[model samples]
Target: MIVAGFACLGPLVILGEYSASMLTNQWPPTLPLAVLAVIQAALLTLLHRPLTAIMETRPAQAIVFFLGSRLMSVYLWHVPAIVLLTGVQLLWWPMPDPGTGAWWLSRPIFVVAVLLVVWAISTVTKRWESPQPILSPRWPSDAVTVIAVALFVFQSLAISSYGLDLPLAVLGLVCTAIAVVLTGGSSNVRAPDVPSSTAEAMPPSPR
Candidate 1:
């Protein structure tokens, strides 16, 4: 039943993105918004329990453990990695039209190249994508992280709006790197001072 609901609403919301009337009517969020939320919640319900159990089991444990630290890296770099891929495409296929013979011939290679590039970048930068705990509870690290994320967001918006600008792209990348360094994402970095235990989920603590 939930799956059916999602299947029905998902298509309409996807198609509605092209509808100017829908945009105007729901400047912030329209029917599509509700539809998408319903779909997401439904899907999460279906997957959450099974995924949690699998992640905890013996077979999947090792893979899950490896991915745990790199989650942020994957999220943070995927967009810019894709943008970088566009530049890379130019080198191999000067004429990148979809219908062109060159494009057809090179499609598989391009896909593989993109996957490899994203993977390489994620591995190299994973350490720096997050801040580590400091000796004395360095407080300023939080603000630096926020600013770094802002820079990344700005770069993503700029790239999406007017295509890639190399200077801005580099600036965003540098900002994240600096943020990581400031947060102690290096050999000097230490894990956050908090105990490495999973406490039961609870409401915000007064302390």
Candidate 2:
């Protein structure tokens, strides 16, 4: 959104001097905002850990609760909600171009309307997508989980910000290499007990 705002501002402010054609064009001051948003999201997610532990420390339950929250459910239903709300809005106050004029570009009313529509749709979808029961222990080992999560975050960000270009492909390969190394190292570390029938049989000879 910050990037989009910059794109719009460029056209108006500098007489459309900034490059807006290419996908890799400068997004002006969006990097700071993006970084801040990422940091805030990480902090907020971490903040939930203590609260979640206080409520229930079970890993499965915690994972379900985290993913099954209203925020996530709402995102799943946002598209359908947008369709419905657009239909209703068109019927009532028909907008030819929602983002045409100066005020229209950043209309809080329109934003609120879309949010309301999403919330309503989310409420309905949440009924169907209720949190599933905690079955088996689904979490991977810590190292594996961390690598998987990092890869996922990077891939998701790349996909959203830029297409699957050379840079993203390189990033994906690097992540894969790191993950493989970590996993290999973890697997090389053996447990203390070495299983053997001879050792088990001769264990109580002196005792």
Candidate 3:
């Protein structure tokens, strides 16, 4: 359904029915947006069983675990990697007609290049996305910090949107860097120490 939503997104944007600003400036959700949300929820609910079943299988579970490890890296780098490689491809090869066999065949090269770039980047930043919790103060704070960091990272990422906006891209890079620093520091923050006097001040428990 995510893919379906993305497929429909372009048309809606082209029709001037939606824009990122609507997400920010619009206070209450419009009927159309609400309906779309409901439809998306229903689609996910329908797919839940099949998705759960796939995860239950050992081989699929292993594949999932592997993918989850580098999911952040892949998501972050794929857009830029594809865009970079696509430009190079356009220069190197004659343009193929859209939806043609030649165009379809050419895609794997871009996909491979993206994957390679993602893997290379993972070596540097994968620790930030590690499942292993660093010595944060408490689980709650750590979780909130992680979520904030992830959200920032997501906003800082590129999806090969429209024309390249160098200023926005640079802003995103700076934001992502800030997230990385926050994440790293928060992960190591120790919980506040309880004094021995405070422990002793508590009423005695009944034996």
Over 16-50, each residue of candidate 3 has an lDDT whose tens digit, in order, gives: 44545444213355444654676688788989999
Which pairs of residues collide in candidate 2?
none
> What's the TM-score of every candidate structure?
0.53, 0.36, 0.53
- Model 1 regions more than 4 Å off: 9-15, 19-34, 94-112, 129-133, 140-207
C-alpha local distance difference test of each model: 0.66, 0.61, 0.68
Clashes of 1: 0
**Candidate 3 structure lDDT:** 0.68
Candidate 1 similarity to native, TM-score: 0.53
| Alpha-carbon deviation at 184 in model 3, angstroms | 4.2
**Candidate that would win on TM-score:** 3
Sort the candidates on TM-score, descending order: 3, 1, 2
Between candidates 1 and 3, the one scoring higher on TM-score is 3
Whose lDDT is greatest here? 3
